[model samples]
Target: MLYPTLRPIRGATLLLTAGLLAACALPRVGPNKSEIFAGSVLREGDAFVLTVDDRVNAIAAVAPALGFSAGFLNAGELGADTIRAGDTLGLTIFENVDDGLLVPTGANATAIEEVQVDAQGFIFVPYAGRVRAEGNSPEALRRVITERLAEQTPDPQVAINRLAGDGATVSVQGAVTAQGVYPIERPTRSLIPMLAAAGGVAVEPDIARVTIQRGDQRAEVFYDDLFASAANDIALRDGDAIVVKSDSRTFTALGATGAQDRITFESRTISAIEALAQVGGLSSTAADPTGVFVFRNEPEEIAEQLVGQDVTGPQRVVYVLDLTRPNGMFMARDFAIRDGDTVYVTEAPFVQFNKTIAALTGSLSAANGVQDATGL
Candidate 1:
């Protein structure tokens, strides 16, 4: 009679323990709506929680625009024929007198095959001394040399011929069909043409980014924009270094997404709906459609616009989308997903409840098996 009484009591105790454990620690993809909202202003949490709406969507859409800056857009034209340092010039000094300087006896003209411009922008002739070669065309440089040689020689005539130059070249590297140093000539004087000289970009045009670094100034623009507007085709300067690369902007898909991974942007800008579709959308069996969230550290300016107040540095923001609502789909369709964001979808409430009931039932079944084994 004692054994019979103890058996039912033991099973009842096991069932109660399992129920308590399941309620306390049910596995979840992430925080539920109540838990996330607990940290809102109404609660003690510091993160700015916002429900997705048209006004919030518009405010958050003001992302950092990726395009050429003023320094790049307002660039002046670069003279294709202008000489620069390290250029190779051919100088021919013609003197009327047979025994004149810079020319062999009986030879009226002296040809100097290669006259390299020094780093200081000066070139040295036999009698003309040092003259500035950079920033002058071949004809302009010839006039300067003639004046210098006229002092000692009678009726001195000078001619300058520009040869193949290595000074006025731009280096193209990164994701391109060809990577090398190319001369800035008639066809390759501007940004777009220079990129074409490298056999165009190796990556997709929609996602390619082209950056131009000239001395201390730097600017970047999308490759597709170069053709979209002619103003974006800024002139290329000497010593300009161009890099063509695939856009590195990415967002992470976590929690109940069909695929949880960091995905690259397929376009220059990605909306919330587009980002979800890229990751195979939410899991049908586990995802809570109402708990879609975007986690980001918004810049101070954008944060102020969203909250309608001043905020310092970057502020923690969590944007929520409830698909159960009528306007939820439209809000998600318009909301922009910025770089370095985490797109998380929480599991449905019923899913966790199901797990708890399963846990409790399993515990009770094990207790019944024990009773049967003991023949009680």
Candidate 2:
């Protein structure tokens, strides 16, 4: 009978040990066992003429007007000018009178507003007939109208009137509240108002990623400085597009890390170590100090391209960094991560097993308690 009792006791001890061992074998699920390098190894600045298909399509969905204009002009032209066709023209005219003598029938008229300019660049005046208005200054247009009307009446009372027709329009696209054409009347229009018309910039407009496309060229501008400084708020020309784009760059931290994750870099640079710190550091118990590994896309290929060389080898390569040493801290700073970098942390074998064992034991204990309460 004593031997039988001893056997049951030993059996219980073995089961407990097995459970703990199984738990130890479980995988680590947090950041302590994993690491993420915080920057893109991919370089975005390189000038590549390759056709951007689906990406361009997605961008167009957010700002359809951009796609329309981009089709008309190359990426480069879109960067500089803001003017586009179908915008209203405003004109001011001063009719010539005998020196300073006012005509008996003369009446002062304000400059015309909303003068419609056809696609052919002709402005229709009520009495003056169709006048070529494209590429002419307001004063020049005033003179042209004055001369034409002079033929009809002596010192024809002509005051260049306000623009009544659409002169040119610029489309505000992407991340704006209302994405549509904005009519330009003056040489200068504030970006805020234009954005307001299209619905102000989309929530959290990638402040650093504003793009202006004119003709074939594309210009990347920072919205913060551009809007803050009056000097930089460049006057918009016809056919210009103000695009508030989405943030393409992002860093994800997942696992047993303290904070778990963070987005956006306050500074231009973020390192693997810095990324870890941003998320509340690593968990000590389940963390495997020696097993820390950072998986990242290979940076050498991009770096090679930046220096101007063709890679004849396979393009598949992933970088692994060991963070066990003090020197590894410097790698985070030296190795620049690009947008879309993912950081992962793994758990230590012992800690993982312990967690699993604890979970199992807790589950069993709860089941036993329930059965006892039910008298089963």
The candidate that achieves the highest lDDT relative to the unseen native structure: 1
TM-score of 2: 0.54
Clashes in predicted model 2: 76
Candidate 1 TM-score, C-alpha based: 0.92
Candidates' C-alpha lDDT: 0.86, 0.53
In model 1, which runs have C-alpha deviations exceeding 4 angstroms? 2-5, 10-15, 19-24, 150-155, 162-164
Candidate 2 lDDT (Cα, 0 to 1): 0.53
Candidate 1, residues 1-376, lDDT tens digits: the string is: 6665665656475757676775688677778888888877558788899998999998988877778878778878666677898889998889999788888997889899888999999999887789998877787888889988889988898888887685478899999999999977778889888888899999999999989888988888889889889999998888899999999999999988889999989998889999999999989998999999999999998889889888889988999998889989889999999889999999988898888778777767776787678776
For model 2, how does the per-residue alpha-carbon lDDT over 100-148 read when each residue is reduced to its tens digit?
2223335443356677656786777655789886756556677788787
Which 10-residue window of candidate 1 scores lowest in summed lDDT?
Answer: 2-11
TM-score (all chains, Cα) for each model? 0.92, 0.54
Which of the numbered candidates is closest to the native, going by highest TM-score?
1
Clashes of 1: 0
